[model samples]
Target: MAALRDAVGRYGIWSAELHTVSPGERGEAAARLEALGYGAVWFGGSPGVEDAAPLVEGATGITVATGILSIWQHTPAEAGARFLELEAAHPGRFLLGIGASHAKLAAQYERPYSAMVEYLDGLDAAGVPASRVVLAALGPKMLRLSRDRAGGAHPYLVTPEHTAEARGILGEAPLLAPDLKVVLETDPGLARSAAREHFARYLELPNYTNNFLRIGFTEDDIAGGGSDRLVDAVYAWGDDARVRDRIDAFLAAGADHVALQIVRGGTPTGLPADEWRRLAAVLGL
Candidate 1:
């Protein structure tokens, strides 16, 4: 099948934590996200290669992607079999996202680039197409490797500045999808707190910390949950307009697609109507 490279609005589920939303809720969330004017559903987390079909089972036109499936957890052979099966059944709707997840977390995360390439070869051996996959790349080496190996790159917790750097490294035609967080509240404390809860877990991860440190963030800035400056730079908190401006920043920076992670209460909304309406208008679906 062909790649789903169409310009999907920069808003969808980061779903980096797919298990957070159950199988039943996955489809429901996809429909609601599309209804809310979001273009794609980027399902994430450590779901085994074959574990995500139910996540996008209910949606039709929307593209379902794994922001990242760990290569360590499931062999490429396994992922390929499942991916090909799903693509045959649903053609042009599934984008397989693979990642050399954090090294510390993997049993033996040595040689991430090599591991990822071998995994891709495994998928090739199993009949999965190169155009049907994406990589979770932060640095330039991985970015180049991604272009050579998969369809493009899907970066998480990255700023528009990072997006620009990535775009430069990737050049034209490679898909560049970045995930952005949004807080619709006007209260500073609440918004910051939300950013903290969602981001603190990532602070200790070497992949994230090292990437930020290389980007010029000070050690102080990399402190727990990220300093306010770091949080504000990475998370687009505040009113709808402010968040929209950040989205514009990313697009202007040359990102092909942006997956907006509406970080708020329970569901995507669970906040207020005005914020939703304003965002929908800005997104243009």
Candidate 2:
């Protein structure tokens, strides 16, 4: 866990867009991110284990991880085998972040806790070390599972308050890295609009909405593309200082690392290298 924490540092970049690009482009972008001093690059959007190959092959120093690979999509044997292959090549540069995923998104989603335990058993049988794996845990039960069975938890769409509660459940040993959305825009309307555009789909997933409710957000707060309070709490918008402070809040609340996913107003895809550079400067990375 200490090694994983050291490799990930305090800040990392998370992008679903990386999966859309060609392998070579992804590799180049990963190398650039390493150059920019990000400790890790998380491949989002339900990527497969092999999806991280190009990133692992490209960046010599930056840690590469699946921000989460759905357990329902890939069998444990396959995921464990692919993880071994990548580990053999890149050694310590790859981390397997797996999740039960959302019920609406996964047809096979049932008894998720049991399924995750079974999946871990299979991974264990297939020679995947528990220390190299992280769970996309949101609820208390799943968070506890992550603490006892895996290296740590990589929670998505969470607030600092949630982070603090998760940390209490996970204790002090396991890694607690949460995904945080960053909107570079300064205008309240523009920032919230972009945040809503990115966050709308997540509202439909009970897993996330339930977690929001658990963390003190009401149904009204989640309705209509999320209330301003909900948007502001979950996303870091406005000036560089404000963004930096928000990210720091997560760390202060017991998050070992914060995976920043930049949200732009126009298109949802693209590398957003310029925005990343600006963030790197502001973060003094």
Candidate 3:
């Protein structure tokens, strides 16, 4: 956890569209994030580790992690090779975050727990140290595996309360970094609307909903694009102060680091540089 926290500081960016941005633009943004004192930049959209190499090269110090590279998409041997290549080039600047992903999203999804174990075994045989990898876990079994095998857990679309519960499961040592969605809007309606827009897709996925249910949300709370209460609980919205409070809450709840997925205005595309800059000032990062 110490190494994971050092690699990714108190806060970092989690943007799925980061890899889709133009190479020059991505490089500039990566460098800017490093300059802004962000500890890491999480590449999402189920990226292959190779996809993140350019961004890792663009930034000199900041850690570059795959928010999650789907296990179904890349075999452990392939992922291990990529990890070695990147580590050789950048040393400790990369973290390979892997997950079983959602059953609905992967055709080959089956016995996720066993599959992850097998994948880790492959990685182990290929010489990828456990310290260099993290798991995208949401439940007790997976979280336990995260503690026993990997460096820690990186749960997505979760709240501070969930962070606390996860901390209990992970104990005090494993890295407990969760992806938090944020909306930088002052108006309640606008903020919730933005949150709902971004959250609607996840609502259809049972993996996320089951996790939400495990954390106490009812089926109704998961219905109709999520309730206002659900939206508020899941997303940190409003001004910088409001967002800061939410970030602080997660840290207080025992999260080692918070990977913020900034939802500026309503769109979740391109680089939200201005929002990131504002958040940096607010967080004093």
Top-scoring candidate (lDDT): 2
Give me candidate 1's TM-score against the actual structure: 0.90
Query: Which pairs in model 3 have colliding backbones?
Result: none
Model 1 stretches with alpha carbons more than 4 Å out: 1-3, 7-10, 16-18, 265-282
> What is the C-alpha lDDT profile of model 2 across 105-156, one tens digit per residue?
9988899999999999999999999999999999999999999999999999
Scored by TM-score, the top model is 2
**What's the lDDT for all of these models?**
0.78, 0.93, 0.89
lDDT of 1 by residue, 218-273 (tens): 89998866898999889887766787788889989988888876676433432233
Give the better candidate number (1 or 2) by lDDT.
2
Report how far residue 8 has shifted in candidate 2, in Å.
Answer: 0.8
Sort the predicted structures by TM-score, highest score first: 2, 3, 1
Estimate candidate 2's RMSD in Å.
0.8
Query: Which residues of candidate 2, in runs, are more than 4 Å off?
Result: none
The order by descending lDDT is 2, 3, 1
User: Model 1: C-alpha RMSD to truth?
Assistant: 2.9
> Model 3: residues >4 Å from true position, as ranges?
265-269
